[model samples]
Target: MFKLAGQLASDCIVLGDFQLCTLLLMNDAQYPWFILVPRREDATEIFQLSVADRSLLMEESCLLAEKLKDAFAADKMNIAALGNVVSQLHVHHVVRYRKDHAWPAPVWGKSPAVSYTPELLNERIGKLRAVLTNGFTFAESCP
Candidate 1:
């Protein structure tokens, strides 16, 4: 069985799951940031996955990046899998804008995370749920 990292559960809103990964929306309202965590136990690196699992992860990641880029109209899409903090095999897909608070630089440690209001949070979730179709399932409730 696989359990979500404690930090991730606290920091992100559970969007839903793909075939092999659980999709999470970072609670920060500053940017449209999302994470895809493989539903594998004790795996902290992509290389740890079996060959088929690695291929599936890449497919899921690309689908997510494309959908996010179109949905957010992002100037650039930043995707990475740095597990320095949370040692879970998760990939980040951040939608960036040229005029964003930390343009031309990584979003990490640049500024404090701006949390989402109730209404905005709902809107963001709804928007994402609408676009993330074809093998994506929306979580009935967030944890």
Candidate 2:
């Protein structure tokens, strides 16, 4: 019964599913950001997850952070799971650089999210998919 929220579906590009979570790329082109949502219905907090699922989420988050850092050569990887907005059990992995648009500050609210052109969106997703497929066992689920 797990389903992505309407706001999430509107703002993210579906990447693929991990063993316990669905991976999504935030639609904002300003940063190399990804979100991981556990495939559990109506669970809004980390504590709501079972102990094993909590451990699995950490493992998945770490692996994704490493891969994103490698793929984008990011100076830092910001991983968080603040649910103030969507109230879903999701983790965010954002690849950051010292010279990025919102350097020295958080990316949220620094600038408006830039929408991607069709070609650019496809290219970005393809690059990410390549890295994920090479590093993990996820099959592409996004068109």
Candidate 3:
């Protein structure tokens, strides 16, 4: 009964699914970004989920943040769940560097997204998938 929101599908690359959420890579070349979307239907806020689901979401979010930070060797990690545009229960994990274009500023609205080419996108996905599978088993098929 779960379906990905249209904006999300168009903007992110499907990484895979976990026990309670789907992992997606934000299609922006400026940063190593990822999103975790809870699979509950019609849920908008974190508290809307069952207790077990809330716990699982936190666990997954932390795991992703740790791995992404290390993999990208990022200076900092920006993780948030601001569902202002897309009213779905989703969390974002973005690896940031001190010298990045937006640097000290947030990665949103500062500049337009720089999409990845097919070859580059695949390379990024492969690296992320490797990092994820090292710790957790994916529920959906992974590349």
Candidate 4:
């Protein structure tokens, strides 16, 4: 499972590079989405991290979720770590709304991916990255 392309072999799916996880953007645009990929060499599970790293990862997840909540003014935050689809040991932290496309249900397999405009994507990423940097600093390998 080891890919030597560095931490971001794919689009970041979570908050920002400030944490051990990278943020991935789901192709859907109806909701604010993100994924967190822990920067470990072919890590397969959260428990695989050292005790200290595990604790930090959890803390970072929670904190980043909070930031997403505030920044997006979202109604709820969906945080999950399911490796069934992509087995790179990545986590998901998504902002949800009552009126979103997959409202009142899970977002998975609900619809096709919605593309984002480059300008919009860049703006949103910049804002989220700012929040991430407020209290977190990225290791060289992370960014």
TM-score: model 1 vs. ground truth: 0.96
| C-alpha lDDT of all candidate models, in order | 0.92, 0.86, 0.87, 0.70
Highest-scoring model, TM-score: 1
TM-score each candidate.
0.96, 0.91, 0.92, 0.79
Clash pairs for candidate 1: none
Candidate 1 per-residue lDDT over residues 32-58, each given as its tens digit:
999999999999999999999999999
Clash numbers, per candidate: 0, 0, 0, 10
lDDT of 4 by residue, 40-136 (tens): 8868788889998798788778888888999999898988887776777777777989988888788878887676776677677767767776655
The true-versus-predicted C-alpha distance at residue 85 of model 2, in Å, is: 0.8
Alpha-carbon error at 63 in model 2, in Å? Answer: 0.7
Lowest summed lDDT across 10 adjacent residues in model 4 is found at: 4-13
Q: What value does the lDDT take at residue 106 in candidate 1?
A: 98
Estimate the lDDT of model 1. 0.92
The window of 10 residues in a row where model 3 has the poorest summed lDDT is 134-143
lDDT by residue for model 2 (89-112), tens = 999999999999998898878999
